[model samples]
Target: MEQAIVIRSEIRKCMQEEGFTLGGFSKATEIRGSYLSLLLNHDPHKYPLPMRHFDSMIQALGKPEGWLYECYVDECFITGKTDRRRVEPFLLRCAELGKTECIERVLSRLMENLNQLSLVFEIAEKVHAAGNQQGAVPFYECVAEHEKHQHSETLAISQYRLFRAALGQDLHKNRFAATRFAPFRKRLPVEYQLDGLLQLANTYYTLSDWRRLGECADELIALAKVVYQEQHQRKTSKREKTPLNTERHLVLYYGKGYLSKATAYEKQGLYAESKKCIEGYADLSWFEGLDEVGKKEVQMFQIFAVANSYTLEILMGHSYVLSEYTNYLSMHKHEILSGLATILESANKYGFSVDETLEMLSKEILEFKQREDLPGLGWRLRFHYYLSIYFLGKGKIAECIENTLQSLDLSVIINNSGAFAQAVALFELCRGQATDAHLNNYKGLLEEVRKRERFNLGFHNY
Candidate 1:
């Protein structure tokens, strides 16, 4: 006789009328099958679903959103079925021991009761920390889907976790996971907001969206300053235990802000500003606690800035910068291929014998070009341009022109001004040896380059 029972019976009737079996409904709504059975067959007075569930079920059944809510008994209150303190330790132990199936079982049971979803979040976090990101992803998705309409903070945390796990997958290389944070941005705490913004800037770099990258860099830098000042005013601990970094969020945000800004400046060909930003990035006062991978990434960025500085110096007729190029390359053996090319080019310019380096580089370039999936259009363009330079250094004029033509073709395809500039410059240098066909194709490619320059998009492709 309970109104809750009546409401549940009506929901079942509506579902049956629409020919939606519990399993079909579960599949359509992405709800767990056992959980759907609990909603349809359990004692509604004891195991009532959340209001959000009613809305989702109704929407899936092509009913009005509030039909189930209107029939619900006012006295039915959802309460926790299991004590979280007792359940969490067992789940955490299972996760720590790598019992993924056991963890999944516990999560499924916990998620069946509406009030036990917090425990689901806790168990998912444990699984994530146990380095089973793929396993944790589904748990986070469940929590987010169930809690999205009513619990903002839980939804934000769950979605962020899901996004991070997806980002870690190699299949997601060309995808920008940070854009998934938009819907949850306002619900995230200040520290997470900063983290999200940092990732957004990284995503912009991946997509080569320079204008947006600059905007995000400026926004993040401003937010970092404000958050740092507030934390300083509160006299918060200088270090916080966090999953992201050992230091406080302040230092991590500050470093990321400058790194992103420097990248934007470098892409815009403002080398001096980029150098200043990179220096600012390196000077952030938390290196003592930075993890090894983080340290290496920062070192790589510094090497990028230094290599750019060296290139600018050479272009401006200051060969003195080459004095330190070899030392820099030696210290950073894992420098980017572009950086390696600068060092080798500098060596050639200085009349140093780079024969061994050029031979090794030629082999490496050939291998890269043979890969089925080129890393990116810009990287491939740079590789071809660098190969041309290497071939020219080896006195192979025909081979050099062949590579230059490849670079020019890709530059035109991608509208990459910087690569086009390099290709055109190389073409001019090689024009003396060109046959009639080469001359005609050169004119067409040169005109395309001129049109691109006239457009003045100013984006650096390399």
Candidate 2:
């Protein structure tokens, strides 16, 4: 029998098993009897099933979710037609529904041909880009595991992306993925290795694993040194060197390493050490020809470092540095609001009148709220989070709670774990002052988040 005919028979059997008559099922599902019969009888020349009907029919017949689609995809695979254009919709349907078992079956078949991995990767990227990080993690893991033995840069890049995707899904899973970074470290091109380390450092930051972040930053800084020295040696060995314009990228790369190290130190409360690293980042010379986007990113880091330096100085009683930091801030646009917000929080802590700063913060928040073109919502959420802190310090519990909840809402929208973490922390801080119902509400939400986190990590033993 034709595979499609066999699938149709299976569907009919499922309906019969559920004691659902064709006319009754059709009426319940709002699918016309004639059309339903055409679909269930499997006329080979009939158009393929629409995805919407598959789910409705599955429910109406008491079949498992994705059962019909999975069977169809399996048939397509067996008939050697899985690569046909028509099969893409079925494959994507499986991915959209998070049918890992079906995806795994498809991956197993594709593994026999290395060239077919691209299709698998495309689906994985599609899942990840759709904000389904959990669904994408396993697919990337499968690809990385299978490709590891291939000893290609492709495998290394796959491993790096998998590590990132896993981190997004669960920090605990990423802890295991981190170990896989080593073998790929030596296999990748130099540029890939550098960027990979930077990416790993970012994951460490996300996990708040300061020690690991510092370690990764050390490796990045060392690699940057080698690149810098090689360029310097080329200049000395010959009277000519690569375009100074190209050198700007190298400088920014090295500066990124230093920036990482500085943030790690700051997290550890080693203010003096952090300041030195940030200064090193700020001292790098910029050359013309660096693209505007790169320049903007690098400048943001520089301004952030400067702002952090101001906070550290104030905390350490070196208040004299505040003037210098404020002078620099005065020159930049209001987009530097993140660092400015931090400074405002510090100012309130030290008895400085924050009225002016508070006004500025409110104005910026209002402005951002009205503008639809702005991106960087994560940063904006963090700004709201910091605003909550400032309000708490001022003993404005209502405003503090308001901004904290706003931060939480925005964090949820953007899926920013770091901001979400801070928002939760703020809620915990407010529990003592809040009513019993509010406290219980906070506890319940936290517990739910904790449960989901453990579940996503596959912590079955726990």
Reference-based lDDT, each prediction: 0.64, 0.66
Candidate 1: tens digits of C-alpha lDDT, residues 224-275: 7786666555555666534433223355666677777876776676878877
Q: Against the hidden reference, what TM-scores do the models get?
A: 0.51, 0.59
TM match of model 1 to true structure:
0.51
- Evaluated against the true structure, the overall lDDT of model 2 is 0.66
Best by TM-score: 2
Q: Which candidate achieves the best lDDT against the true structure?
A: 2
- Per-residue CA lDDT of model 2 for 1-462, tens digit only, reads 265676677778877887889888898778889888887775544445555676677777776677756566555454354544544555677777877777777677767777766676676777777877677766677677676466766667667667655554344555567767756775767776777787778766655578888888898889878876776778679656765333236656677788888878976879889988888777543533346755766776677666667767765545456556655655654545555555655565565545554454454556656422223454456567777888788898877877787777665444446656768788878866776656565566556666655423222210
Q: On a 0 to 1 TM-score scale, where does candidate 2 land against the true structure?
A: 0.59
Candidate 1 wrongly placed segments (more than 4 Å): 1-116, 168-176, 234-252, 272-276, 282-308, 311-323, 336-338, 341-385, 388-462
